[model samples]
Target: MTDPETLAAATVVVPALVAALVWVLPRTWVTRTALVGALATGGLAAALTAVALTGDRPLAGPWLVIDVPGGLLVGIIGAVGLVSVLVSPAYLGAAAGALVDPRRRERTYYSALLVFWSALLAVPLAGTLGAAWLLVEATTAASALLVGFSGRATALEAGWKYLVLTSLGLGVALLGIVLLAAGTPEGGLGALSWQVLPTYAGGARSALVVYVLLLAGLAAKIGWAPVHNWLPDAHSEAPAPVSALLSAALLPAVLLVAWRCEQGLEPVIGVGPARDVLLVFGLLSVAVSVPFMLRPMAWKRLLAYSSLEHMGVVAIGLGFATPLALAGVAVHLVAHAVAKTLGFCLVTPLLAHAPEAARSPVSGIARSSPVLGGAMGLSLGSLAGLPPSPLFVSELLIVAGGFQAGRVVTATAAAVLLALAFSCLVRALLELTLGEAPARTGPVSGSASASGSVSGSVSGSASGSALPGLRGVGVLVAASLVLLLALAGAASWLPASDLVDTLMKGIA
Candidate 1:
């Protein structure tokens, strides 16, 4: 097979095998094996991205294929997935440390995680809208289970809500897909394949209906407000690592599909109809997230609303369809993935020391856990669109791109709303990290923990391995910084950046 074919094949195959292997492995191997699988999957994506950079991607075909656009999504998904998985152990171990018998639960957790990971890996490889829809649905199934992995009442409710809402949305989207198929030659599915589908879709009488249904359905999954009820609940209730995947990876992947559909139909239905739908969804989403963000809530809940806002920004960027706006979409997608991953992962460590943080924000990380404080602060800052946060740069491009597209009024409104969000988010972060410090809390314990792990575990490992500190979360903090820097660099000066620009312009 050619290089793209090989990379594309491995993209799905390796994750499938790893998921199966990890499921049946003895307890000791579940976490470690899953981590390895995550890394391997990410490595393959990175290699594929490098190939895409060289402008030698495979043609979009009947099944798995590679091109600049697909390559970018694949690369971001894998990289973000790896980050989430690396931090999973810490979150899992913390949860385990609180359990009397964590082995069984750990097995179930990691197995579900691999399944979710596999589904996430399949999305960009899909060759047809039908196939992409199936992959997106598969993700909901696998991830709903992981969202409620703890099986707590809230987690269970979050999982149920996520499944029902997203499934209903997907059901609508499927109808649109069928209609899209009918719009083809003699209504055959062949014309509905990715390559030909778009050209055939927008000319039919049902084009507007198809576009609206598809947008509504995708909006629910993408966490756009008016249909975003599931987002905050699930993101807040799920384990931190899973939250990262849902927000950073899954949301964007689903959006990628919707983006393809939008661009596909733009030719026949007219760009105005499709673009307007995205703009409405985008505006409402940004507007809705701000009020929720301003309210004092749990850290993850706050971040969850932020996810909604960022998704809105992406929608706006895609709708504008200008070179700069599209580039902003690409930049923001990666920056948001990395920054949000860092933000959610920090919660795991925070919760380790202070479980009450689940319901309310913890104050004074800056004074006590300076490393944690600095990292959390950095994450919040980045998310708030501060300088040094590539999100800031991306947002600028998006607004400017909108203006350049002759969308001055809409761009102005979005900019005003985003500025409000930024200010409110900064205040929220200060409340989380700079206010009164929570009393140094005691740790819970029943299972094993690393040395100096936050729980009842001792400072030194039984095997004499070194540990970070009372929290043992410093590693996560440090990793967040590194990722933040990497994200900034990639936005400003990566070798593949021109490739990203080309891909972005295609979407535009």
Candidate 2:
């Protein structure tokens, strides 16, 4: 095997080269070629992850660093990206109104997807704050196109909303980065690198200003409340594969950037203020998502709100900044990624079989197709924090960590919020699996498409173009169940593991 650094670079480069190749490839060859590239990208990323996890220290390159947290993220992005590519052929086959010219539609979609995948792959491994920020911004452009790929008025509007909102938030973050750089002793791009930021000499007032600006800006991109107005619309409007990447890969990758910021600045600004900022964001996000979850919203829309809630959980775990919480955050990240991806991937089959699910709650999914229903059930159940699911264990660890950190009230409040959210999701699960099926009167009148429009119908079915994709989803669901259970089992010793100790020591 190649060295870790070489693997890391290849992970980002292979997809990019594929993106370029797909742009010029014949329409007939786009999906096949893209899949090959995706396999290579995933292989390299997974190899790098193994190298990082086994090493005692961060594996550093000139432009990249594969630390434990970064390694986990790379692995998640690789897995999610590969699955997205796997499902893209099915999506494109059934979809219409694509934003690009008909002759170039396949090439356009695959190119944008591979480009977006490459950028997400790079963000976790970025060696400096500036590079990470640039890579994240690159994702915005590529994914916004994917989000609006349907070319419908609603899809286009949602895409534009996502682009504008995230860009604005990133702008604010850029200002904060500039401020930090100006105050650093060496006063260069290198000063803003993760390794150097911990030694920030900036005074308390300046540091506080920088911290607020950074967190507030990152909050929008992470879909944290108050700045998450674009999240629901974008997630609901994008293609199923694209939605999975947004919720599972993009959100957490950006959150990692925020985590790095906190670690870098804590020594300069004091832990109290930094921790408080994160806690506020986390609690507010959870509070905001609960009421929405209780409402009988659309399927993709509900998952969108759930993303807000789950990201909040991870944020709170980060804020607690204890060994147990870090461990919980780790487990939660992997569990949430798997569960959320499965949920979104199911949208293709769900929408194809029952178009009405786009506007109202799903019902009796199990009665329609056993495989589809079972997968949907597992996805929702896992998200709801049911026992035997890793999320349940992770949440417990987070609460315990909060107490260990001496924030009893905060921990208590978070636990209460989580319980309330859990009940809401459980109710949703029952309604999803057991509620009476909606009467399909002819073609659905106002059935929303995966693209967030009401015009598209079930152009394909489980026995049609979507059949292979549904089979793929079934395989993913089975794999996820075993993986999540393994994570739950691993939680027993994760808190005391060397990785947790390394994280607790502060990566910066």
Candidate 3:
């Protein structure tokens, strides 16, 4: 088969088949088989990325396109999906007490997860604006079921809010898509295809209007402020693996479309207007997240804010739109995907060791659980943009790129905000990983006070419930660190290519 066809089948059809097969499998085997399938999918994505990097252009078909930028997102979603699947066994174990019918719920949960995985796969491969929007909405529906899978009252509420709010955003996005389609040369569904739309609408007056409407809807769906009310609640309430996917995959995948839209409209509105709009959205997202990020917070909610901050970083990079900046944006996307997955996965052990600590103030991780503490510390460092972390390099490049683009004020603002965000995250990480575990009274004891040892203290708590030590955790942490190393070198080390040039050429 042809390369484009091969990549499309692997990215889209294979996952759909696996998702269907999951329900019929024995519940005990579901997680194992899903991981295997997800790994294979990730491998395919990596191969596709390699091909795109070497080729002059993306492998495109009638309904799908696999370009360098799109391939990066595809690879990210696939890699994060595999990691989330790997982490799911532990997540399911942590939720065991709350699940009424272990076997049935396991089946239901795995089914939903695979379906969610399949929908994510479809997102980056979508060729047309309408097709991309539909796949994104599909993700919301599939993940909402997984988010509320625990059946807790708050879980249900979070799920409903996620469904309603994101759906509203998608509705708005659809209007923009229809308007964009109307303005294209042929003025049909085909006009909205990524490859064709840019050529025409990039210089159209109507395209400017479409771009504004689309960016607003995308900002909301992607967890930008003023419309981000559902993000923290949903991420906090959902299972850890699902939370990882939402942050690592869904947000980026949707933002990919928004970035492309901005590129297409730049010629029509001029680069300044489009970049200014994105810059405002990006900066506002960064600023609005600060107050929540500064205080003591739930683990998932904190990471949710981190997602918002990083997405803003990406927007700022795109607004800069130089080759160096675009390169940093590419590297940053991969780095954040791997690092954030590690951050979310570490919470599984925390839940198993100190279930109450999920929402409680952080304490005793260093003394109680060395592995969780180390993993979390590294994640915090990476997310905080500490030296040797890819994020530090990525953020630096974006700032430098902004200056080169003559956006001195924007560059200064970005650097300052990043430093502030870093301090807050590092402080929170220190509090969580160090210091004595808070002592709880009565039948429910604390991790530090119970047995003077990590395992025993965790086991002693009634809610802690004796769960097996987390598996494959060390591997996830090790992989994330290695990914950071690769990201740090990616901007300079990548072979001579027109990837960044291609991405920027159409923008203005």
Candidate 4:
């Protein structure tokens, strides 16, 4: 026997060890170091998934558990991390080339990215809720450096804000964890494992208090309203690749934690109370992010708000707790990850050519780089839940689930908010894709050749400059398309009942 328990722990710890190695590697070898680290993480993720699917049963150990849900999430984080590393050569290559100390900065960036990936992978595999909490905190710490990698005054400020807000949120979550521990049988003193939660979940009052505390605290981390101040700043300031990972991977990881916590408490306080809280938060996040999306701002910031909106949608699906809704939530998480990553990748090249593209003032990207323009259009369209996109299927499932759950009013409100969000996003996309290219001044005849020369020079030297290669915008777009097809096919064939059964069993 290949010792599933040992494999499960290794799946996570090995990545962390690799990240540490990347941190110490010579500056000149930063690219190779990052690639090696990412490859190791991806391989482990693949192993974990295979074990979950083909192994006899869930792998259980004192430190970790490779259950179906955890396996699925681990695979996602790993796959995405791999793509991130592929893109990093190009993206971070461009950044490093522009830096005062390129070698040192490249090492720092790659190290931080690897560390972030390792932390993200660890959370889902944790056997205990306490360990999960620690992993989430680790993600914040590792990503914070990446957020402020530019070392600009604004980047620094944004990083500090992110640190303070997330730390506070984690603190509150810790308090909730402590309370839950205290309420466990035998005066709450025990191993504090997630597996034991159901056994001691009978104390309604304590469970309710702990659930509320945990949800409220973690809600901040998920970028829910009122506490979502750090999102725009952090996402906007971070490199595009980092931003993609943050939005597409990090937020979902925290949401998974919240989902697990809800499952733990549902048996005690009933699903109604937990659903109610999710509904409230979902509505608030939608309402708060909508107006921001409508306003003119940086391209990355706009995407960040879009992330908030999507998180709200995920919350709604989770609150419904119906099999259809949960399935939708699952599919939507995948859809959002692919769409957002592609969108971020597309914008990277655009921003390089026209710095104002980030501000939404420059237009006509379709004429400048038709491929990227189309990719951006498709990504936004998908994110808006338009037909043919996986988001559409997920949102519909969520709505259906809400109706089934007798939350007609809630469903109606979510639908309306989604429609409004869709409209706003569509309008922005049109302006960016269809408008005339801003006029260039001075020596129009030589501009084309000059621009081409510059573009070629930039692309030839740095990894990011040659984006058509592996892990480039082209690859991201292809991946998005494939995922969308898979989602649509799965939705059409997968039974809702089966999803419900799996969710119930997994959570129970």
**Each model's C-alpha lDDT?**
0.77, 0.87, 0.76, 0.75
- The per-prediction tally of clashing pairs is 1, 0, 0, 2
Give lDDT tens digits, candidate 3, residues 22-83: 77987667777777777777787777767766667666665777777777787888888888
- lDDT tens digits by residue: candidate 2, 100-213: 897888899889999999999999999988899999999999999999998888889999999999999999999999998988886666877888877777798899899899
**Which has the greatest lDDT?**
2
TM-score of each: 0.90, 0.95, 0.91, 0.90
- Model 1 Cα lDDT, one tens digit per residue, 1-508: 7667787788777877888898788877888898888889889878877776576434677665466667777877887778777777767656633211345777677777777887887787787788889989999988888877776677779989999999999999999998888777735555667666556634655787898898899889999989999999999888888898899989998998888888777777887887988989898999999988888887888999999999999999988878778778877988888789878877755555455677776677665556566777888899999887888888888898899899999999989999998998999879867888765633334332211223353232221112222244455556666766776666654323566456644432
Error of 4 at 467 (Å): 6.9
Model 1: residues with Cα > 4 Å off, grouped in runs: 96-103, 201-205, 441-476, 486-497, 504-508
C-alpha displacement of 21 in model 4, angstroms? 1.9
The TM-score measured for candidate 4 stands at 0.90
Best by TM-score: 2
TM-score of 1: 0.90
lDDT of 3 at 221: 78
Off by over 4 Å in 4: 1-3, 53-57, 96-103, 186-191, 200-202, 440-471, 497-500
User: Can you write out model 4's per-residue Cα lDDT over 156-197, one digit (the tens) per residue?
Assistant: 887899989999999999999888876677443234576667
Ten contiguous residues with the weakest lDDT in model 2? 439-448
Clashing pairs in 3: none
Q: What is the Cα-based lDDT of residue 364 in candidate 2?
A: 74
